[model samples]
Target: MQRKEALDILHSKLKKKNLVKHSLACEIGMKRIAEYLGEDADLWGLAGLLHDIDYEEIEDAEEHGKKGASFLKGKLDDKVVKAIERHTGYIEPKSTMDIALYALDPLTGLIIAAMLMHPSKTLAEIDTKFVLKKFKQKGFARGANREQILACEKISIPLDDFVNIVLKAMQEINEELTG
Candidate 1:
């Protein structure tokens, strides 16, 4: 499906404004990471954008990724659907796409938290170094798992490069994300 079609589906399911923006951030980050890794950007992006489609509808907290996967099973590529399921660590990320989503999930949160804390409060104003400092702070963006963010290194993508690519992707869509 096209991005617009996916956005329509995403919007239909998600109620929170911030959650939608988070999905957008994930889409951009997923696409950029796919490009960086010479992977299929479209499928990876759809996975990222829809990974949290079950967020607001989750009955059981543990059903997060499972619900999303079930919802998306036949709608998208199986690989993308599986990546969405594996992203939450419900199943360990095995594919490059799965690992990227696993790592990219919290990484976007980290970047968003870093942007919010920036003096200028803009993604453009914060680099990976600034975000790295925040990563070391135990109390900062407590929901953004530092260990998962570090999973970039597991896939042979250096942590710094992952941060840089994701940060730049968010910056490119700063207005959409910040507004």
Candidate 2:
């Protein structure tokens, strides 16, 4: 399916504004990573955008990816479905796209959390150094899995570079995400 259709599905399922913003932030991160890796940006963006489609609906946290994939089975490509399913890290990420989603998903949350902690509370005021420092702190954004974010290393992208790329991507869409 196209981006617009995928977004419509996301909006229909996720009622909370924060959830939508998170998905959009992930989409920006995915698109940036896909570009850097010479992959399909649109497809990667869609996978990131819809990865949490069932988060609010699924009672069990583990079922979020599986059920979301099931919900979008016919509408999205099988690879996209599998990426969405594997994004939660319950399933091993086997493909580049899968790994990208897995790595990008939580990092978006971490980036946002890091930005919020900044005195300015804006993307422009935040930088890679700040985010990397926060990444190392055990008590910071505890919910954003550090291991999952480190998945970028499997693709040979250094943690610092990955964090910078994601941070810049989110910054480009700062208004839509934070406003």
Candidate 3:
């Protein structure tokens, strides 16, 4: 399916505002990583955007990602499907983009949570130091899934480094989403 069509489907299917924001965050984060790595930004963005396409379908949250992958098979590239599948912790990624997507999926939630607590409640006002501090605090956004956020290290980049990359990327386009 075309990226636009997939995105439409995503918008229509995902009703929760938090889930939609998380999807957008992952898309922006993955696109930035792709730009930095000289990979296909659109492909990365599409993968990130559709990663949890079937998240609300499966009864077991644990299998949602994997099921989403299977559902996306033949509709998207194998790599894209794989990235979606592993976003939920069911599998390991084999490429830089996949690894970045996996690492970014949850990290963006934590970053957003941190940004929301700020006086401005905007990504433009968030800083790496603040995100890092929140990342270390287990009490903050307890469901942010630190383990998945730490998975960015699979590509040899530290958690803070990945956070900085995603945060900076989001800040650059904060107006697009926040406005």
Best by lDDT: 2
Residues 1-179, candidate 2, lDDT per residue (tens digit)? 89889889999999999999999999989999999999889998999899999999898877879999998898888999999999988889999899989998889999889989999999888999999999999999999999999999998889999999999999999899999
Give Cα distance to truth, residue 11, candidate 1, Å: 0.5
Per-residue lDDT tens digits for candidate 1, residues 70-125, read 98878889999999889988689899999999999999998988888999988878
lDDT of 2: 0.92
Worst-scoring 10-residue span by lDDT in model 1: 57-66
Model 3: per-residue Cα lDDT at residue 11: 85
lDDT value, residue 149 of candidate 2:
92
TM-score of 1: 0.97
What total of clashing residue pairs does each candidate reach?
0, 0, 0
Instruction: After superposing candidate 2 on the true structure, give the runs of residues whose Cα lies further than 4 Å from its correct spot.
Output: none
Error of 2 at 147 (Å): 0.8
**Pairwise TM-score winner, candidates 1 and 3:** 1
lDDT of 3: 0.81
Leading candidate by TM-score: 2
Q: Between the candidate structures 1 and 2, which one is better when assessed by TM-score? A: 2
lDDT of each: 0.92, 0.92, 0.81
